[model samples]
Target chain A: MTNGKSDLKRLSRGDTENSGGAIWHENFRQAINILRSHKMRSGLLIVGVAIGVTTVLAIVTVMSGLDKRVQQDILSVNKPYLIVSRFDPFAGTKDKRDLMRRKKLTSSDAEAIEDRCPTVDRVDLQVNAEGMMSVLRYGNERTNLIQVMGASHNFGYMFSFSIEKGRFFTKFEQDHKARVIVLGYGPAKDLFPHRGPIGKMIKIGTHRYKVVGTMGSRENIMGSISDNYAIIPYTIYEKDRSSKRDDYQIAITIRDGFTLEKGIEETTALLRKRRGVKPGEENNFYITTSETFKEMLGNITKYIGLVLVVISSIGLMVGGIGVMNIMLISVTERTREVGIRMAVGAKKKDILQQFLIEAVVLTGIGGIMGIILGMFAARGVAMLIHFPYSVPIIWIIIAFVFSSSIGLIFGLYPANKAAGMDPIVALRAE
Target chain B: MLITVKGLKKIYDVGSQRIEAVAGVDLEIGKNEYVSIMGPSGSGKSTLMNILGCLDTPTEGKYYLNGSEVSNLDDDRLAYIRNREIGFVFQTFNLLPRANSLQNVELPLVYAGVSAGKRKRIAMEVLDLVGLVDRAMHRPSELSGGQRQRVAIARALVNNPSIILADEPTGNLDSKTGEELMAVFNKIHESGNTIIMVTHEENVARHSMRILRLRDGKIESDKIIN
Candidate 1:
């Protein structure tokens, strides 16, 4: 009974020790000292972690930038519109030959959709001569080769943009196949650096066409909006610019009170009926929205990102295992010191924290190095490709936290082993 | 009484063999007493000293330090007692190799959660008491064996612990240096502190006011030296 009472009393509180958080400052110094003493081993672990983090950061930055570029291009029309085409525009070039096998959908199909699908508010047709890289020339001044598009009369309204300087062409001009042309800001600025381009006759290919207006500025990067393009009437293009390999695209806006999804459904049904596609068979053409383009870009990026992540994880895994092994060895090497510390009043928790901090400091330094290197790589590529320059601050923060967490995870077993040691046996260790 | 032990026992399992390191030893020590424990190599003197210092618990017995039974205390509380009540001086001096003499002395106070300024001040006081104030910044490897042991002694006294447990404090020092350390110990005892030391040498045992001899895990004799 007396022994039982003593055992019960033994479970009483250890009096809070009155020791504040200030006691562990020496532990931090000790951890730094320990890591410093083994420079080669610590350096190897840091490099390993740095490589993994670098891979993750570089891949994430490139993929995000790619998405940003695709989004900017897909939404440049500035309206919630549908693009009906022969194949998916944003499917990438991986399987071009297969996608090209689909049948073409012409201006006739665009006309039918506008008439049959009441959800369609307005429709515009554009055609690109696949290889028409025409140079625009003025008096002793010439601009680089850029594709010229043949658009309907209401192209400016459909694009939700007005001319920056002059007026858009009229329906009579499109119907009469007039020789008037409008230049995108890029080409307009180049051909008329010192003078106004409007009403000026510029040579496109073998013919002279008068510049009627200049499109407004959008992005400085050479995205869809800022492309150095020249636009002429659809009738003019069909007569003078249409080649055997021309590709036609139909842009449609949904009528008021119609959901985009409902409009798309109606258009798809009508197109299938018009194209004579059999029931239970795939459609002979593609219809995409801006959201659809975004989804396609996301799918491609997700696959590439996953692959890169797995590879970097393998690198980090190897690095983490290396850290754990060296930490175990460190615990063994410092067994006597741990015992002396215990005899001087250190709790098991104190020893565990000491080793854990050492591991984190080592990997934390690696994380910083990796972030710097990855930013350099991303910035270099962005400059080369003319993407918007930005610091991926979120990914940098995530990488740092992730690398520190790796140390915490891998350092646990070794630290627990150190803390669980019997002080007597540790003191007796040589 | 500063310490009391009733039928203390310690058993170790080495593979299938059961070894009784300490069996049925009863002892008492009063405040400010200077005592020495002596025995042959396998006579369990180390095990008994470890039990007395609360470094290891007794398997079957009662241990009271400062009038409270402490043998059944859990590890955290036992660590607290080790920090606040008992100071251990190892045979090898056990000074942390990389730490300077002052930092070594401040170890116990650091664990006690003493603030930085107070820890340094109190550590300096103990270093002065051990006559190592001039060598406070010198690490163990840079100091002589006797100087290193004095640093260890200063560390042991820094927390103002109730008892100092010395395990062959002079074992690594020359005879002259050992005699000097013994004189320091005598001075410490006269200034009202309890000290327990373990050694096999009779001359070293003579330095203490009382001597206890151990044989086969039991107390063979207890002698008082006036």
Candidate 2:
């Protein structure tokens, strides 16, 4: 009876107006209150959705970071340069064996390409120890990161290698077959932590070489294997190994204003004429550009990404099913409330929308938590593996939408059941 | 007539057996009539009340509210009828436990699509009419039994329903609270709103101007107590 007169006076003004907005607001408040009241149950359901979203986002972030790293690695070799190898670097075993049986490319092929090819500006030939692992020794510090490669004096210039300390091997050293090596950044840091690497003696597989220069890192390769190689003059490697059938790789740089296609064509014609290849036969060697290797790496990464998507989709499915089961239980527990709503005249669609919105809101919250968790986890993993850190915005959007849709699809059945209940029977239930 | 039912029957199919909850019941209620239906347990009074309230459909017969045949309407139309024409008051004062009395009273207005400001005004006015304006902000759990019943009555009246149908309105209260509720109902009836209540107690039926005693799903006696 308190404030009775004022209440009646206030109610006299206009009593009829559309209450749809107010009703919707009230329903949402009620749903959130229900979730709050049952904190453990709601938290469990949210964790289910969070786990699914986290799995997908984390895997995608890691894979995307790896893809970017590999692409950068391929691009670091500089442009307008072609790699002519005896075997396709990205090919299967059969093509490699066929190229291996034909004949190992010698230093003569590099010299012929440099002299006769019209578009060629300069060439640097490399000979690597095939399938041989070298253990490097410097006093007491030992490392298995000894990738011993022999190259010409022009190797640093053709590959855009910048010296972090000291200087690259001179042309006189290449002609003299001197045992002078240039350490990559990783080997330089590891082998000479206390002092400068210049004038230091390092052993490569029982052979000794003085460190003349150290090259800084160009790009982060996915694995840390990019900076592990130690380079020496091709004359030194050939004279020491005493091998005639050395499989040599030729790196040709096209002259200014010349296309890579023209360079490849002129090199191909000169090599075929010099080696006496018959007409209508395929070239014995393989030609690869930076773009080709980049595309090939992308394809391989795509397969791995596809497999990861399949695995995460299963996790999402499991999470979606858990959401459905919990929704059903919620409907059963609130049967009396549904009856009360119907008695006051709520239509089937109202009930359906109420539950559907609740489900979406629940999963939406889960999606946000998952994104935060996944990004942090991916950053941690990238740090552990030395891969580049990349933020995948598109994947984040996709994961958010995917998680909410899972709620929409899975929450439909239980919402329908709640809407289809008979008001009389529901009211009669305890 | 505000309500008319002819040869109304409600049959429940329990497995292979059929149970006739309301068997050929005929009744007529005029505007502003204060009527009480008296019956023992299992007398089908509850089923009859459910059918009249539009919460359940009759298996066979005709029911008219304000001269419109509503015997076999669709669920949506029936929901509209329940929201606009009929107001139900359950024995337990079936209020949403989460909502306060004002919000509870505004429920039917919400379904009628009234604006929030108007709903609050009308609900407050109805609460004032029931002399429970102070209790408007109290949830059912916070209010006493008589106060909760007043809130329920306010909810029933807020929408200006054609008929306020109450089943055992005073069944769950102490005798003094029940009589106080009866006094409130007398005042409502005096204000000229039709009301039909079902109760087993004779004293409860004495408050109404007319009484119908039902047994075995049929009317055994009818009388005017003026």
Candidate 3:
């Protein structure tokens, strides 16, 4: 009776020692144990995945952010369906560079299209003229070699420019060729350090023009184009300049519900007729739309993104291969252990899942670390360059999923080999 | 009968040449039977034990356990049989070295799809039966050889399988520890579970009720030792 009571006590205690949760938890525990056993190997494997995911994430965030900014800037400059001067008529021909240098559109041609093309919503003409070699003097400070631009009265509305101070020049001032000018934010601060520029006179070359308005701060597109220029009426530019050739560029916004393609077709026919070009002769002007601009920008960005993704994938591939090789080594090192498991009724699939899960967990942890590092790195770079920092959630999710899948795919061969091992032979393996 | 084998044979192929590991053998083991098979290296004792444990299928023969044909079963069905009816122990004290004694014992029940609470209770019961309840959380590496073997014994008993197959279970232990492990096996057998073991030592074979000695892939002697 004493022995029976002791046996029951023993049985109760033994039961407590032998059981846990579900099968997945058991497998997960075993998997974590195996990975922890080889600390250096597992650490190195995770580092590889981290580097791969970091590279991919950083490049993706920067590229997508740049893309969004460029699209926004383009839309601000012109509507999606608007057409602009393409600079060169025969740019696609063999002597494209030479043809580009020869083709120029004058303001008269822009006016002709506006009058003849029914699909055109509005026409804006922009022309640049040389400012006299003069210094912008306000009180005691001065700046040299500043660029100045001349535009029609509709320039502010057409290009979405917002006035930060005062107001734009009226149609009366523009028609009378008034010597009133609007200063960009940079020049405004440089010229007037203490007081407002409204009603003040600034000398441009030989003429004095009143500062009627000032533009807010604007960012340059793609890091090369400059937005630090002063604006005046086109009549003032023509009256002051000596050149007979008008290098005026035209921007034509298409009417609502009108396709850019149709607008381009009709505008092209009208321009050709107005330019007096015969049917056999090639058209002297070129037409470009915002969509074409976006396509060209996208192509360049796509190439950059492809290169970055490829470089990152190479890192991941190396990391995945490293994981596979190390896991194979683990199987060989633990051959007897696997044999014991098989003998004790662990199925082949069980062994397979165990190893595969370990690999995935290693890579998954690495991916998480890499994403955190990459996001901070990208934000640091954006801050240094004064660009808005954009956190790309989609790229973060993608990096994690991609790295884990790499682990599963690459770990398959090693796991299958382990599962296929013969228990007797494995037990005997040294 | 808990286990039945008829004309069991196993052949291995190496580079287009076939070598017979186990020739022909017939055996029957009833409930609560304690048996030992003794043989030198390569004498087919291990092969026969593997077939009995459902770890290997005979090249040509039929094996029935609890009245079901296991020799012709597919891998999934065979795995099911192994999980539900057979427990195994090995000379190396084949517990997962990183796992604690309790976790090692609970493995088979996990495969059996038992719930956590029930599996834990059963595993703890077996550990107590083997007198290792105090060391349940100790990993195999942390335990002595005898303790490791006892853990293996606890693991073998956890599933309440019909048969416990042990191969040289005390090969890595000293004689005194080996005797202690044998005592635990005796207790397990007294509980009405069949135990089949392969051993090379005469004293180890004498501990069982029946002994079979093999040479050159054939059983040279069979006797009722007790």
Worst 10 residues of 1 chain A by lDDT: A4-13
Off by over 4 Å in 3: A1-21, A37-40, A72-75, A78-81, A84-91, A94-123, A128-148, A161-167, A183-217, A221-225, A242-245, A252-288, B12-19, B72-76
Q: How high a TM-score does candidate 2 get?
A: 0.86
lDDT by residue (A272-374, candidate 3, tens digit) is: 7776779999867777877777888788878888888888788889888988888888878888877777766667887787778877888888899889888
DockQ of each: 0.27, 0.45, 0.37
Return whichever of 2 and 3 wins on lDDT.
2
Error of 1 at A366 (Å): 1.3
- Candidate with more favorable, higher TM-score: 1 or 2: 2
**Docking category for candidate 3?**
acceptable
Best by TM-score: 2
Q: What is the TM-score ranking, best to worst?
A: 2, 3, 1
Q: What tens digits encode model 3's per-residue C-alpha lDDT throughout B94-136?
A: 7877889998898777776667777678788778778889999
Misplaced by over 4 Å in model 1 are A1-17, A73-80, A84-123, A127-150, A153-173, A178-232, A236-249, A252-288
Candidate rank order under lDDT: 2, 1, 3
For A1-430, candidate 1 gives per-residue lDDT tens digits of 2232232123112423456564668787887888788889888889988987887887778777766765665455666788888887756897688767766667678778888898998888888877778888998999988878898876788775547778778888988889989888778888999988889999987888889998776654446535578889877988887777788888898988988898889988998887788999887678888677668767887788778777877887787888799889989999998899899888888888888988888788888988888788878887887665565689899999988888899999999999888888899899
Which portions of model 2 show Cα errors greater than 4 Å?
A1-23, A73-75, A78-82, A103-124, A133-145, A152-154, A157-162, A170-179, A185-194, A200-210, A216-227, A235-245, A251-280, A309-322, B190-192, B224-226
